[model samples]
Target chain A: MRSRRTVDVPTLVREAREGSPRALGRLLTLVENAAPELREIMAALAPHTGRARIVGLTGSPGVGKSTSTSMLVSVLRRRDLRVGVLAVDPSSPFSGGALLGDRIRLVEHALDPQVYIRSMASRGHLGGLAWTTPQAIRVLDAAGCDVILVETVGVGQSEVEIAGLADTTIVLLAPGMGDGVQAAKAGILEIGDVFVVNKADREGAPATVRELRHMISLGDRTEPHLWRPPVLTTIADRGEGGDEVLEALDSHWAWLQEHGQLEERRRARAAGEVQALALEQLRSRMGSPTEGVLREVVDEVLAGRLDPYAAADRVVADLA
Target chain B: MRSRRTVDVPTLVREAREGSPRALGRLLTLVENAAPELREIMAALAPHTGRARIVGLTGSPGVGKSTSTSMLVSVLRRRDLRVGVLAVDPSSPFSGGALLGDRIRLVEHALDPQVYIRSMASRGHLGGLAWTTPQAIRVLDAAGCDVILVETVGVGQSEVEIAGLADTTIVLLAPGMGDGVQAAKAGILEIGDVFVVNKADREGAPATVRELRHMISLGDRTEPHLWRPPVLTTIADRGEGGDEVLEALDSHWAWLQEHGQLEERRRARAAGEVQALALEQLRSRMGSPTEGVLREVVDEVLAGRLDPYAAADRVVADLA
Candidate 1:
C-alpha cells in the first residue's frame, strides 16, 4: 500500500525548521493530503509554530488580496521579520487544474531569502481550510517565520472559513467594488477582526469606509467593546500606508488580549481544530470494522423493519 | 425542572392533521425548538410525509427566488395540487428579527388554501436548515400536500443544505449577474437537477442558457442518461412563460424516471435526511455524559499532556 513518493518526515521537519524551502514544500503536501504521518511531522516541529502571527487576508476577487498580502510582506520584512505567504486560488472550473497565478503577481519578492510564498487551491475539499493551507502555515510557523499571511479567494463562505483559521482576520474591501460590500452581509462581515479599505487612492474610499464603520456600530449598540474595527486605507501596489495597517492590526490584537477575547477566540479555534480532526478520523473509519455493525442497523432501517432514527440510535448505542 | 405548561402532543398532532392552522403552528414551534417530545411527535407523523414532491428552490438574491416560487405555486394549483412553501431566512443582523419578506413578494397565490407559505429563521441554530423549516415541511408533506417548496435566503451554504432536503433541486439564475459563468462554482450549481434562466426577457437570456447548457454538457460527457437537465426561460414576476418552465420540469422529471435517476435522487435524499438528523442529535448531545467522556481527552489535548491524533484514536477506540 506504500506510495513511491513517500514523505521523509524527520528530515523534512528538520529542514523546514531550518528555513529550507524544499522542506517546507514537502511538509505542505503531506498536510494537504492528510497523510498518516502528519502528526509525526507536526509534533517534530510544534515548537517553531507558536512564534508566527498568522494573518488571514480575504476580499472579493478584484479587491487586490494578493497586492495587499505582498504589501504586508514587504512591510513586515522592513522590520527585519521573516514573512511567509499562503495565497489560495480556486481551481479552474472546467479542467479542475489550478492556475497558481497569485504567486506570479508576487514574484518580485522571489529573490528575498526572508520571504516565502505558496499558492494553494480548494483541491475539491469541502470543509473550509484549503487542505494544505493550514499545514503550510504550521510548517512556516515552525520554521521561525515571524509573520504568516493567508490569502483566500473571497467569494464569502470559504473566505470566512479561511478567516476563522487565522489569529488575526483582515477583511479587505476596495473602492468601486459596490456589490462587494453587499455580499459581505451573508457572513463574511461578521468574521472581520480587522477591515482593510484597500485601494484607498480611488474615489468613494471615504464613503465606503464610513459605511462599514456605521454598519458595525449599528450591529452592536449595547456591547461594551464599542470596538469600531479600524478601516485602514491602503494602496497596496504602491506599498503606501502598509505600516499603518500593521499598526492597526497590532492595536486590535492588544485590545483583544486586554478584553480577554483573544483567549476566547483561541479556545474556540482549538475546539474547532479538535472537532475537525475527530470528523476526519471518523470519515476514514467509515470503512472500518465498526461500520459493519452500523451497516446492519442501516439494513434494518432500509427494509422498513425499524425506524431510521431509532436504528441510528441503536447503532450509536452499540458503539458506545 | 419541568415547565408548568406541558404540550399535548397527541392533540396537537390530531389538529395538525385535521387542517387546524393553530395546532399546526404549535407543532411547528415544538419542532423548531427540537423539544424533548420531538421524537415521539415525528414518529407519529412519519407515515404522512411520503406523498409530497418536495422541491428545494435556491440561488443568489435578486435572482428572483421568491417570484419563481410564486410562479411554481401557481403552476401546481393549475394542476389542482395542494402546495406548501417554506422560506428560510436568517435572523436580522441587528435586531434578531425575521425579515419574512420572501412571503410578500409571492403575490399571485396569496389567497389560495392550496398554497401555504411559512417563514423560519436561523433562531441561533448552528446547522444550515432553519430548525423549523424541515420539520414544518414534514408536517405539510403529511397533511395531504402534493408539492412542497423550500426557498432559502439566497446567501450560499444554507441554500445548498436546503437542496439536500428537497426531492428535486431547481437552481434559479438571472441573465447578467456578472459572475462570468463562474456562476456554477458556488457548489449550488453542481447540485442543480434543473436550471431555470429567470428574467429571460432580458438581453443575455439566450447566452446565459447557452452557457449553462455548455456547462451541463461538459459535466455529463462520461455518463449518458435519458434525463438531461433542460434549460427553461421565465419571466416569473408577471407569471409570463411559467407554463414553459413547468413543462421543462415535467420532462426532466419523466426523464429522471426513465433513467432511474428519480428513484436514485430520492433514495440519496432520504439517506441525507437521516444523516442530517443524526448529526443534529449528536450536536445537541454535546456537553452531555456522552460529551463528558470526550471532554477529558480534549482537556488532555489542550494541556499538551496528549497529542490530538493520539486522542482521536482513543476516542474512536472508546466509541468502538
Candidate 2:
C-alpha cells in the first residue's frame, strides 16, 4: 500500500547498505510486499548480490529446526561471518509477528549488529513462499551478509521452492519423527543437498541416520557427477556437531563451485523468480472476480456455457 | 497428448453415462491432461455433475489410506450406492501407472461395474494436483457415481487443494503415525470435516483420538454455526468400524446441506478451477525457457540488467 512518493527509496537503500538494520528491515518489507519501488530497490541492490552463501535448512516440525538455526547462527558468528536469517513461518497467516520461541532464541544476536534475523509469514500471498522469498534473499545478500540461512518446515511445496533458492539445502530430521518415509513422500529426498539428523541423543537417531542413507542410495543416480547427499547427526540443543553440519554445507558449496553448479543454480533461481513475477503480474492484470474479461469468462464457466479451459484460452487470446 | 480427432468425444460421454467403465476411464484421462477436447467433454458432463457427494481422504504414508478407501468403496457398494475413487498420488510424478498395491486391492471392484477406481499421479503437470482433480470428479459424477472419494497423502499443498474440491474432507490418522502434531503442523486441522483415527487396535489409538479432539477444540470457533469436526475410531484394515465412519460422513454431508455450506463450497471450487485454468493458459502462452518474450525477460533479469518485477511488468505489457 505504500506508494513511491510516500518513501524515499534511494535514501533507504543507501542507509541499509551502510549497516542500518532498521533501514534494511524496511527495505525487506518493501520487497516482500512487492511495493511500488521494488524494481528501483532491486536495481540499486543488484551489484551487491551474488556474494552471500545462501543455505536453506528445512525439516519437519518438532525436528529442532529453530534450535539448529539458532545454533548455526552462533557457530557462524563464532567464525566471524556476518549472517542473516530468514525464518519463513508457513503456519501463521499473519505477517510482522514473529514466533515467541524464535524471537527469544534469536535475541542472542539482537545487539550483534552483524547478524540480522527476520521472520516472514507466508500469508495472503498469491504465489506463496516462492514469490516473496527471492526478493528477501536479495535484500540480505545486498546488505553485506556473508551467509544467509533460509529456514522452512520441510513438509510442503514451500520447502521444494526453498531448495531452488539456496546454494546448499540441508534437510534436518530427528529421532522418531517418522521422517524417512515422510521425507520421501513429501519429495524432500530429491531436493536435499545435505541431510542432518538432529536430536542425536534420542533413541532412534542412529536408525533415522541409517534410513536416510539407505533412501539416498536408492535415489536416482543417473547423473554421473551428482553430489551425493551426506547424512550427519547433531544434538542442536547442546550445540554439538555444529561444526560437522557447517562442514557439510561448505563442502556442498565447494562442490557446486568446482563443477560450475553455482552459476547454473543461480540462473535457475533467477529464471524461476522471473516466471513467478510474470505470472503474478498476469493474475493481477486479470483483475477482480466481479469485473473485466476474466470475470466474464469465469461467469461463463460457472454457468456451464463454456468450459474452464476454453474460457481461459479466450481470455489469453483477448489479452494477446 | 491425444488430440480431438483421435477420439470421439460425444461417443465417449454417451458410453460413460451408459455405465461403460472404459469410456469413463478414457474421459478421466482426457480431463486429467487438459486435452484439446476438454471443453467439449466438460460441456457434455456438466449437467450430470453437482449430484455426487465428493469426499476427500488424506493422511501421512502408512496410515492405510488405500485400504481405508477400498473398505469405504466396499461399504458404499454394499449400501447399493455406486462409488468412484480418484487416488491422487503426489509421490509419483508419472501418470497412468497406478500403484500395484492399490490396483490389487481395488481389483475386487474391477468386475463389479458399480465401483470405479482410478489413480491419478501428479506428473509433469505445471498446476499440480489441483488442476486435474475436479475434472476427474466430474467424469465420475456424470458416470452416475453416488459417491466419489478423492484420496491424497495429507502432506503438502495438494491436500489443502483437495480440501477445496471435496464437499467433505476426511483426515485419516493411525496410531503411532505422529499424526496429531503433524496434522496441526500441516494445517490439516482446519480443513478436515471428519477425523478418523484408523488402526484403533494400536496402543496409541486412544491417545491420538484424545489429542485430535483437543486440537480440534483449540481451533478457532468464532462462527457459532460452524460445524465441529468429529473424531472417530476405525480399524480400516479389518473393515471394523467402517459403518461408523460412513455414518459420520453421512452426518457431515447432511450438515453441509442443512447449513447451506455445500453450495458455498461448490461455488468456491468452481471459482478456483476458473482461476487455475486462466493462470495455466497464461503460463503456456509465456512459452518455454528458451523461446518467447518470457525467456527474453528472464534473460534480462538473470543478467541483472532488469529486476524481476520490472521485467514481469514489461512482459505483461507486451502481451496486453
TM-score of chain B of each: 0.87, 0.93
Task: Give all candidate RMSDs, comma-separated.
Answer: 4.7, 5.2
DockQ (0 to 1) for model 2: 0.31
Give, for candidate 2 chain B, the lowest lDDT window spanning 10 residues: B94-103
* Number of the top-ranking candidate, with TM-score as the measure: 1
Taken over the whole model, the C-alpha lDDT of each candidate is 0.69, 0.81
DockQ of each: 0.20, 0.31
lDDT of 2 by residue, A1-320 (tens): 43445778789988998989999989888766668788789888876777889999988788888889988999999999999999987645443445555457677777999999998876535556777888999899888999999998754466777888899999888888775556655577888899899899999888888877898898894488889999999998899999999998889989999999988788778777877788877766766656777777766755667776676777677666
State residue B41's C-alpha deviation in candidate 2, in Å: 4.8
lDDT of 1 at A115: 88
Span of 10 residues, lowest total lDDT, candidate 1 chain A: A90-99
TM, every model: 0.82, 0.78
